[model samples]
Target: MISAVAYGWKVTSNAHKNHETEGFKQRAEDVDQKAVNIHVANIICSSIQPLQNRAVLNCIEEKVGPDEKFPWAKFRIEKGFGALEKLLKDHAGRYATGDEVSMADAFLAPQIDAGIKRFNVDMVKFPNFNLENFLCI
Candidate 1:
């Protein structure tokens, strides 16, 4: 995740050069906003991924058995999603951060995809979250 965020910053910086012009100034602002969004998304992903990892799941399954493992994962994910939903609801524009696709979207896309597809999480429960729209973005 750190690598991914670092890559995102590098890519964004290289792509959106801060030239001295009115148009470039606006572009710079957009790039800055994207960096902020990516940082926030990275923070969020860092918080959640640890709880959802194979080792964590294995521990839970060993302690509680296979039948209860799904519930454990679901509970943790839902809790994390609740906090994320609040943040996104307050600040989201078109995607997790804003109108453009940023690092935040990049981080969230695969997580959400896996949560919905692999875990069968009911994403509809998060009314503020637009998974389909975000995925499109």
Candidate 2:
């Protein structure tokens, strides 16, 4: 559990890529909001979830936290995910690009679920990010 959340934290880290793609095509403004970090993180982390299983949710608050982003290297997870929740929606939504799973889905699975329970995040603020995270496998 601690390991799973930590993995998600790593994916959500700042260094992860949320870069604008497709020639920077966006709706409101530049797609600086775009992110691929959660996807990769979820994928790897989600795979580990079964091992952690019940232990994962059992160890939030301390193991996982709020007000920060994920880190590939390692750091304070609670603080990192704390910052990330700010940019996401509370509920997971359909895949960003149709039904097919992308790298982003990987990170979102355990992450959003873990985030909601661990940090008490309000996903409305981070709409795009929220929907993706809210959805289940």
Candidate 3:
């Protein structure tokens, strides 16, 4: 059983590596666009993650209550998404950066996912933002 589990883990790891390698190759093909996407992703991370992450939310809920944390997280995510939307409007293609996938898309996709799934953020409010689009790439 142990050996079978180990083999399964190795296979999964290899598949993940292959997928990542393909993504990297796509990003490399458009260096300038990828850089822009990465910059936008950095902004998203800096502006939102600090306030919306699980640790901070847990701390807020512990200190105050669950109701309080939701409002706070919603406000921060909207603000961050506003900026992200503007950036996306200016530079976004099929993905956050451009037609090609990049580190920026990689970073922002998960953040949006967490925001919507965990915090119940209303993503539809951001006209220019689409988590599905980013994730598909």
Candidate 4:
């Protein structure tokens, strides 16, 4: 996953010198924002999303039980969300990295939506990670 994300970044970086037009403001020129974007993306891609993926859920259901999958996925998602909230606490504006929509925001929106709609995540627990306005419905 890391390699894939890195490769995409490299390709995007080379192909588009200015990512602002691509909706990835951090990938444009801001180093710190880029770091935040990468970290946030990694958190969701590496740890959070995989927990609910079909393969992992199947494994858990086979090894543990069908009932355990939701709890396991929910726990990991909340934990990852908490980390993201802390990581972006000082940097986030209206979006994940800043006021403008960036790469992190793009990556996060879907995950947040999935957590709510698919996983039944209780957004009320994550007060700071509220992305209601950022979601496109």
Q: Which candidate is the best by lDDT?
A: 4
TM-score of each: 0.69, 0.35, 0.70, 0.80
The residue pairs found clashing in candidate 3 are: none
24 Cα displacement, candidate 4 (Å): 5.3
In the range 67-120, model 1's lDDT, one tens digit per residue, is 998787877877777777776776576667665555566566666776787577
lDDT tens digits, residue span 1-137, model 4: 55444554564455446545544454525788878878988898887777767888898788879998788788888899889888988888777777776667656776788888878988777665656755761
Candidate 1's displacement at residue 68, Å, is 0.9
Candidate that would win on TM-score = 4
lDDT of 4 at 45: 82
Error in Å for residue 63 of model 3: 5.3
Alpha-carbon shift of residue 113 in model 2 (angstroms)? 0.8
> Which stretches of model 4 miss by more than 4 angstroms?
1-16, 22-28
Please say which candidate is ahead in lDDT: 1 or 2.
Answer: 1
Could you tell me which 10 consecutive residues in candidate 3 have the lowest summed lDDT? 3-12
How accurate locally is residue 44 in candidate 2, as Cα lDDT from 0 to 100? 40
Candidates by lDDT, descending order: 4, 3, 1, 2
Evaluation by TM-score, superior candidate among 1 and 2: 1
Candidate 3, 1-137: lDDT as tens digits? 44322343344345445745544432444557656655665676578766755788899899879889888777877788888887778777676666655556656766677778877888888766656685564
